[model samples]
Target: MMGRTRMIGGLTAIMMILAMCAGCGIGGDGAHDAVQKLMDAVVAGDVSGVKNLYTLSVEPKMPTILTGAKLKQPIQNVTVGESEKVSDSERTVPVSYSLNGKKTAGSFKVKQDADKNWVIQNPPVFGQVSFDPDLTIGGKPSTKDNKFALPIGVYEVNMVSDVLEGSWTVPVKASSGFDYQGITANKNRKKIKLTDKIKTYNGSMSSLIDSFNLLPMCRKLKELYLNGDDFAFISGKSISSACKYQTTDIQIKVTDYTPDGDRDGYYPIKFDATVKMIAPVFTDSGENDDVWTCQSVQGGRQCAKFVEQSFELKDWDGLVSQSNGNVYYRLADPDQNVGELADVIYAGHGVD
Candidate 1:
């Protein structure tokens, strides 16, 4: 949510700056001259001149947040917004520059940098660079371009191919719109790649995760949770979801593999999940979405819901994994019915 807000604000600011600079005598050369003047003023220790060029919230200096020489010299970073070309003027344009740690106001400008890089030149009546990303280099605070950014993190991948079909790789990559929660919520979550290729059936390298859902086991586990039962003995069995139960069974599936089927990472991670209910006997098979209270079974477990079996998912080659990497067995017995549960069970890799 925070990132989304910033993106919108950033775009808006870019557009505004471009529109205003359209009248300036701004161009590449103008930008250079503007930047050089600002830099010279800064190097000459002219704090007022620098602040005058900034678009502050009125007031030439932030007496409290940032003041005088502190803003122009002691400052650490400046972020120059993208340069806008002036339509009529040959040597003028508008740019936004932010000073770091100043909480000061932003300013508009017209001009170019000393290195011929574009820049905003005018002096503000009472502002200074308060938060410019371009000036955020580690060693030199007065510098711009902050240079290129490097990525972090390490990843491992696995891919399996099909004879006639394409293949699926771990961490399946998918087609994602601009990742918008905007009104046009493009609900279609297909897998598309950087090269613009739609991975119809084969996943590349981003959507791989294995999962299992033992509903009966979960219901039973939930009962244990309701009764404050703990089955901490299961190795790597950290209580994941529905914090109330001890696990009776777990149904997990591998990412690149399918249940009697095949896996293609082009789709979101898919799996059959289950939740078992153990309680005094919450409900019998065939009830609407509901949760009731009851006594307990012989194993010191509460029986808020009576669940006899788990539910297995069918035709699950394409679906999304829970945003949560953890299990979601918490809401198990909201509608407890223990009849004819179709939960999936596996035997390999210590899952049995």
Candidate 2:
């Protein structure tokens, strides 16, 4: 969990570059002033101040949730870099909010409004969302003449199984990614038997099924709609996963709980290590407050140091995902070890 290497150097570099550009690029008093205001707004999560500096008309794009975080280490050596103008309307800035000695630094974006107020808009998540391999790369020109800011990863997917055995299995994670690792007690990969008990999925259920994963459902859904063969047995590639969507649920499961949440859906925010990350919005089970947050003592900074946050740009009532897979967290019920084992074993078979 600590040391994860990204083979995509160009992609990683681009992420760094974009993050730098995000911090706001300008070295001097002006840059410091911008950074100071932005940091204060960010630390306090003052929507108004952030909006004013970033020049946002409507509510600015804050993180999805501003809950608490567990400082696995001390958060110290806080550093703020100048903001640089990346585009006519945007600027990137570097910030390192550290604790103890461990650090997590990233660049953030500050965009200018028509009236010229620098507003922090783009969250790092936008970059996290760009995994499309068809994405253009390098200085090379793609068919659309659009150059991707980074190199795309080859989204390869496969399925392997004793076809003699009839069963729906999930792909297992191997060194080279997903691999078909036979069947186990965890998941009952039936051995060549046409049984009525089959776990079948269609395009309509999960809102998040892109054109890629839907290949498995082709038998029932008809031809493919998206591009690419992120799946195993499937052939041909499509353009995008716009064909699939995500699933919807009302159960609120919190991990990193925080109080500074948008008017959006539920989020997990933990206070200290106890309090059991709660989301008052969905469960209405935890304590309620206008603004919830995490608190921990470290390096004398009390708690309240902003760690992570989320805000829903859409999802008025909680229809968060048009498809499925946009789950809050991958958790298991304490009462069901067998269920977990089967699920884990099921992940071995090829998705398609």
- Model 1 earns a TM-score of 0.23
Runs in model 2 deviating more than 4 A are 1-32, 44-76, 99-101, 124-352
**For model 2, how does the per-residue alpha-carbon lDDT over 159-189 read when each residue is reduced to its tens digit?**
1221112223221111111211222212221
TM-score of each: 0.23, 0.23
What lDDT score is found at residue 225 in candidate 2?
16
Q: Candidate 1 on 55-154: residue-level lDDT in tens?
A: 3332332322122222213322433333345433324333333233333334345543345344443343222122222121112222232122111011
